[model samples]
Target: MKRSVLKFGGSSVADFPKIKDISLYLKERIEKGEQLIVVVSAMGKTTDNLLASVHDLTDNPNDKDLAMLLTTGEQQTISFLSLVLNDIGVRAKPLTGYQAGIETIGKHLKSKISSIKGDLLENLFEEHDLLIVAGFQGFNKEGELTTLGRGGSDTTAVAIASAMQCPCEIYTDVTGVYSTDPRIFPEAKRWDQISFEEMMEMSALGAGVLETRSVELANNHNIPIYLGKTLSDEKGTWIVPNDQILERKAVTGVALDKEMAHITITYPSHDRQFLSDLFKLLEDAEINVDMISQIQNQDGQQFSFTFKESDEKELIRLFNALKETYPDLYFKIETTYCKVSVIGAGMRDMTGVASKIFKTLLDADITFYQVTTSEISVSYVVDEANGEKATRLLCQTFNL
Candidate 1:
């Protein structure tokens, strides 16, 4: 029998009725003799509510305790989903990540999947039973429960597929991946298929459809992913592993982020020691910097460095460290900005891509702060308020 892993997002199981619909879908597939492993996230807004409650009680809740509390959300979801499956005459069982033998390495909030002991799942598969595993929560060697930050469900599903050596399918509110966020661009088109590299860029830059880490795992394992709507029969986006057959669309998608800050530091000399110190400080503060740039003068006597807003606090700490160390270098930090990118696998071979991208924004009179690129993508930092407009124009220009 062919085995597969099915994962449902929070929206897919947002309420009782939606759960019933998904359960029916699973039941139909099971009746047809497909061995399945189902993974599910917390119900709609459960995680948000839990976070709110934690914040209300304390400004900074303990990470381990918070993870323990949040994992319960998925437990509730999978348990209810299991009951709904049985209610429809489908024999199903719910297992928490620990019960399913999912083990992780990190401390609490940002744990990574370390290992999975599949003894229980293998036995259940031998019995020809459908296994429903809670999506995100897992235990460490210390037996402490942990959560896989935001987007954990997607990671959970893909990890399970890798462990089980089967393909995985994801069900969400949208039928499939779109050229851009459909809510922002009403005309955003859906791709019949997308490559793993392109999908990773989209997921990293704000593609809401799937978690970036999950895509990474799928790419590593050469697993195919199916994205379908929970209520519709329409075939969704297929993430393909083989690049040989993958077609390159000049503009596969557009991604945007409004929460960012920009910081730049100029120094009389491009002191390697000072730069190393700044990076170490940011690392100590656990700040993630994006789109960093550095340049030196013709004489190589002075240097300029710039980075994104998400690293503001860390940058500030680094800035102070530089002041203490050099006492002469200057730093200028600013916030209230946005970053938008046009992503496509075809960009790797496409010429004049940046020119076309900029012309679209120029036609709309959109002023951008800075621009950067990867082999497969180009991104611009712009005014925060114009984020939606920027996304719409790129979506239209590329006919995404």
Candidate 2:
């Protein structure tokens, strides 16, 4: 018998009424002979509330304590969802990530899925009418609770589906993956299907279409993701294995991110040793540089490079810490910034992708400070205030 894994996001399982509606949706699927495993996120903004409590208590709360606090949100959802299913005369069992055998490594807030022993889950699905598993939280070999950090719920769902060898359907607030954010561009159309590569780049480039890690897992395990809206029967985007037919034009989507800072290090001269030393500084500070670009000075000696502003604070901290050693190597940090990216697989083989994207911005009279690209995506750094306007104009030009 074919099995299907269904995951509902915070909005999908938000309230009692929404739970009831989702329960009906599941019940009908079960009645039709589909073996079901439902993964659910924390009800509404429960996780956010818990994080708020953590923030109030400590500047950097212990990882173990935070994980314990975060797990409760999903636990509440699982228990309530199981109860709702039972109330509807369906036999359902709620399981935590531990009980379902989602094992991981790492302490506290940043754990990665190591392995999943699904025997218990298999038994429950065989014995019960439905199985409801809490998403996001997992356990390690030592039986310590762990989490996959931000956007963990989506990763949880994809991991479960991959481990169980079934397609996972994700229910969120949007009807499907849109060319652009519908909130910003009301006329944007939802895509019928998106290749995993495109989706991965889109998510990583700040599209928020799906969690990047989830897309990575799906692509790794060859699992399909059905994205749909929770509030309606609208068929959302289907993220599947890379398909030639599904590939779009030079640009498939546009994305903008507001959380960025820029840091540039200019030293006395452009030397390989200085470049290596600077990167080591970032590594020591644990700053992840995104969209980095380097240019040689006119003298062909000194060098300057730019990275996201999110790394600005740490870069400065590290520089100040080492100011005595490399006074000349110290540089300035800039924080006010945003990045807008045009992501697609077609861009790799196309000629005018970048030209068209930049032209759209020029036509809109939007001044961009920087431009960067990978084989699958191109991004521009622009003023934070014009982020949405840039995204809308690019979306219109690409007809995304």
Candidate 3:
């Protein structure tokens, strides 16, 4: 029998009706001689509601306790899906991360998956052709429940597929990946096929169609992933290796990351030791720092970096530690900003792509605060309000 792992996002299995529909869909597929493993996220907005409740009690909820609480969302989904499948006469078994033998090691809120029980899964498959597994939640060595951060379910599904050596299918609200967020611009064009490299860049830059880590893992393992709308026969995009495709667009996509914060620090003098120590501190704190810039002169040195807003509280706490030593150290931090990125593989061999990007934004009178570039990408930090405008403008300019 052909075996594959499939994942459905929250919106797809938001309620009993949708869950039943998906169960029936899988039943038909199973009857057609295919073995399946289904991964599910929390029901629609369940995780958000749980988060609101946690923050309602305290701003600094304990990570261990938070992990315990949040993982129930996916567990609820798995059991409910299992019930639906069973009621419809399908041999389905629901498994949580621990029950499914998924182990991880990292912070409770953002754990990295370390292992999966492929032999156990295949053994279970002998009796039941279908296994419904909870997504986004895994257990650490300490036996504590851990989540893979937001959009982690995508990673879970991909990891399981990698273990099984099969192509993975991810179904979400969108029919497929787009050049930009369709909600921001309804005219955003969708791609029939995208390279894993381009997909990773888009996810990291805030396409949000799939988790960045999932794409990275799939890329590393040479796994192909199919993204499409759930419960629909619509043709979707295929994410494959770069060498599989012959043509490359100059600018394939534009992404706007709204969860970014900009922080700038000014030191009294250029101190290499202090810089190294601060970076080490950030690393210890697991701060996701990006686009660091530094300037030095006879007077002092200025340092700037961007990180997700979710880490702002931890970052502030870290800064407090530095205050006792460098009382005169100055820093400016702002959360009301977003990063707009232009990405394409063709930029590696094509020239002037950056020129057209900046010129387009400048002609629109949108002032960007910071700019960073890579071989195949250029990103700019701009006011949050202008993020949509910049995305639309750039997508149009690039004909994305």
Best by lDDT: 3
TM-score: which candidate is best? 3
TM-scores for every predicted model: 0.89, 0.89, 0.97
Per-residue error for 93 in candidate 3, Å, reads 0.8
Q: Model 1, which residues run further than 4 Å from truth?
A: 242-246, 264-274, 284-286, 295-335
Clashing residue pairs in candidate 2, if any? 261-308, 261-309, 261-310, 262-309, 269-301, 269-302, 270-301, 270-302
lDDT of 3 at 295: 88
Superposed Cα deviation of residue 174, candidate 3 (Å): 0.3
Query: Taking the tens digit of each residue's C-alpha lDDT, what string does model 2 give over 55-166?
Result: 7888757778788889999999999989989988888999999888999986567787888776777877767878888989899777888888777888988998898899
Looking at candidate 3, what is the lDDT of residue 133? 95
Instruction: Give lDDT tens digits, candidate 3, residues 153-208.
Output: 99999999999999999999999989999888788888999999999999998788
lDDT of 1: 0.83
| lDDT ranking, high to low | 3, 1, 2
Write candidate 1's Cα lDDT for 1-400 as tens digits.
8799999999889999999988888888998988899999999999999988998899757888899899989999988988988888888888999998999986588788987776678887765468899988899999999988778989999999988888999998898988888888888888888888888998887677888999999999988898988868797988987464446777789998665677677777766888788778766655667777777885434333345454565466667776977888787776667789899877777788789988999999999877878878898988888889999988878777
The segments of candidate 2 whose C-alpha lies over 4 angstroms from its true place after superposition are 244-247, 266-287, 295-333
- Flag regions of model 3 displaced more than 4 Å: none
- What's the lDDT for residue 67 in model 2? 85
